[model samples]
Target: MYAIGIDIGGTTIKVGLVDGGKIINSNRKPTASTPEEAVANIVLQIDALFEKYNLTVKDIVGIGIGCPGLISSEEGVVCHISTMKWHNFPIVSLLKKTYNTNIKVSNDANVAALGEAMFGAGEKFNNSIMLTLGTGVGGGIIIDNKIYAGAFSKGAELGHMVIRIGGEPCGCGRRGCLETYASATGLTRMTKSAMEQHPESEMWKFVDGDINKVDGRTSFECAKQGDAAANSVVDDFVMYLSEGIMNLANIFRPEAFIIGGGISAQGKYLTDKLTAYCEKYCYGYKNAPKSEIITATLGNDAGIIGAAALVI
Candidate 1:
């Protein structure tokens, strides 16, 4: 079967075509500020692609879209998009008019998780969680091969799990959320805080004492050098990160844990650290069975791949 997958991110919208779980064509475009315009722009792109391939909408099985907002996948509408300034936008309805194909719309993170479950790390387990530690720690929980969206289409907002009460302010206007201390942004926060406490530490030298200048890579680099400040930052971060994992482990007890997103490029640093801390701190678990916290193998293609799986 052939399908098109679209991921609407804050800055870019990634679109792709998939044939039998493989990406046949893909491209990235700037996200339109208005839902009306975005939908129209997407239609043009889709039509262009079909025209290029000498195919029509009838040739495809479905079109799946993932976006950042409160989406009623069952209703095929986006209820609210805080960043997009959109309310009650019927994205599926708009697309259906053009494609006349099976259309699936859902939260972008959930779609990503779905994709991972179908084709990436989560593929090995019917029940698993995909943790994406990017600018924010986005996540998706897959159980029985379906996304566990909450009643309000707000389920699995795992990034907002309050790992630390009043710890750090989050974009969600909440304090001490898991994303506050576990995401790439959180990593920068940790590095800055560490450098402040140990101005003489190598971390300060690395960033030239410019706290705001620190980033995820700097934290990883300092950690590798065994800098006290960097180690302290990791230690503090692991407290919240492992706690979040422990919470998930205790809840679903999934077969494996898949960590993805940009920060995941740190590889062994994140895996080894997260594993050690999560195992050591988990409650009611004597031995940490192999949960297989593997890095995602599919990378950015999961969105397209998973979107296609909607028809599968």
Candidate 2:
């Protein structure tokens, strides 16, 4: 049976027809400005998909949605979504009423984790954690082959975990969150700081002195060219990332820790360094089979595939 998967983001809404862990057809549209408009857009997309595939409601098993913010998957309610100004939105019930079908919904990060665990990098392992290091650090945990959203579906906010007592202030109004140091934005900030410190560094040349142009790759690229300042920045970034991973390892001890997002493009270079640091810092690393650190395989389709898995 086929399932429809919808991923709601700040800028876009992605929808797909998924079967057996694969997205058969997909479409994307700009996010609506209001909750009502968003729901209407989703219904329109679902109808379009149905018509395009020549299927009826009975042909689909269910509709699954991955949304941002605090979500109650069981209740199908979006408690709060800062990016979209959605609060206590009854997404599942609304969708169910419109389509008259089974509907499932959960936090976007958690859904992405489920997608990875069921069909991507974590497929081989029963327990795993996925960290998406994009504009911010988004995390998902899987235990015994199932998503583990805490009692209120608010658990697994890994990025908010305080790594330092009085460190950089996070967007979440917290101090020293892991996201402050390990995310793509955080990496750019670090690169900018390094460039400012070493005015003669090659990183400035890479970004042409425009601090805004500096991305997660600026420091790594400059370091590849033997820029000492960039190298130090990378070293510091890896150190903070490894510390966070080690903490997760000691707590969850999952079989694998999967890294997603743009920086993951660094591939083995990133994973190798992270693995080494995790091995050194994780508690009792020598006494047990260490959790492998790897890059996510699903890429952009993770959310769609994962949302579909909620019904499968």
Candidate 3:
């Protein structure tokens, strides 16, 4: 049976039809302006796939969706997604009207983690943490081969984790949140700060006298090109990221730590830095799992793949 996995992101709605752990068909559409309209659009997209594959509802085992914001995955209800302009939407019921088939829904992060656990980087580990480094640091925790959705389906709010009590102000109306320093925007902020402090650093030269060019990639580029200022900013961000992960290691101690999303593409350089930094703060890394930190193998498809694999 083929399963359709859909990920509702703030900017786009991604869907995929999969079988045997591989996505054989997929498509994306701009996210709906309203919850109701969004569901309708998804149904239309699924119908297109159904026709293309020459299959009917009977051939589809299930449909799974993942979205940001608070939600009761067990209940298939969405609650207050500021980024998506959503509030109290009954996603499961809405989708049911269109398919009349079994459906599953979950927070985007959790489902993405599920995808990695079932088919991507965390497949080898029974216990794992999946981090999506994008506009912000999204995440999901899997334990005992099942997602730990917490008591209220709010298990993995990694970006909101407070690394500093009174650091940078976060859009979540909190101060010094980890997302402020560990995300893309965080890197930008750090770069600007670094430039202000070290006006003559090598990074400034690479940025072409434009602070706007000093983004995360620019910082990484400069660091790779041997820029001390950019390296310092990268080090500071990595230090904070590892510091936060240390607490995760001390508690979850998963079999593997899978870093997913765009930012994680930095590869071994990042994992090495994160590991070295985390180890310093870890209680005792000498005998710990050595925490084999690895990048996400599935990339952006983790959420969709995980959603499809939900029925597997």
Please, what's the RMSD in Å of model 1?
1.8
Which pairs clash (backbone N, Cα, C closer than 3 Å) in model 1?
115-306
How far is 109's C-alpha from truth in model 3 (Å)?
A: 1.3
Model 1: per-residue Cα lDDT over 102-140, one tens digit each: 899888788888888888877778988888888889898
TM-scores for all candidates: the values are 0.94, 0.97, 0.95
Give the winner by lDDT: 2 or 3.
2
Name the TM-score of candidate 2. Answer: 0.97
Candidate 3 wrong stretches, greater than 4 Å: none
Between candidates 1 and 2, which one is better according to TM-score? 2
Write the number of the candidate with greater TM-score, choosing between 1 and 3.
3
**Candidate 2: global Cα-lDDT?**
0.92
| Model 2 lDDT per residue over 148-230, tens place | 98987888999999999999999889899999999999999989988888999999899887888999999998888999999
Worst 10 residues of 3 by lDDT: 283-292
What tens-digit string does per-residue lDDT give for candidate 3 at 1-312? 689999888878888899867899899999989998888889888998999999988898899888888898878899879877888899998888878888988888888898898888888888998877777888788998788988878767878889899999998899988888888888888888988998888877877888877666767778888888889988998888887787788888887888877678789989998987776668778765567788989887787898887666
Highest lDDT scorer: 2
Which residue pairs show collisions in model 2?
Answer: none
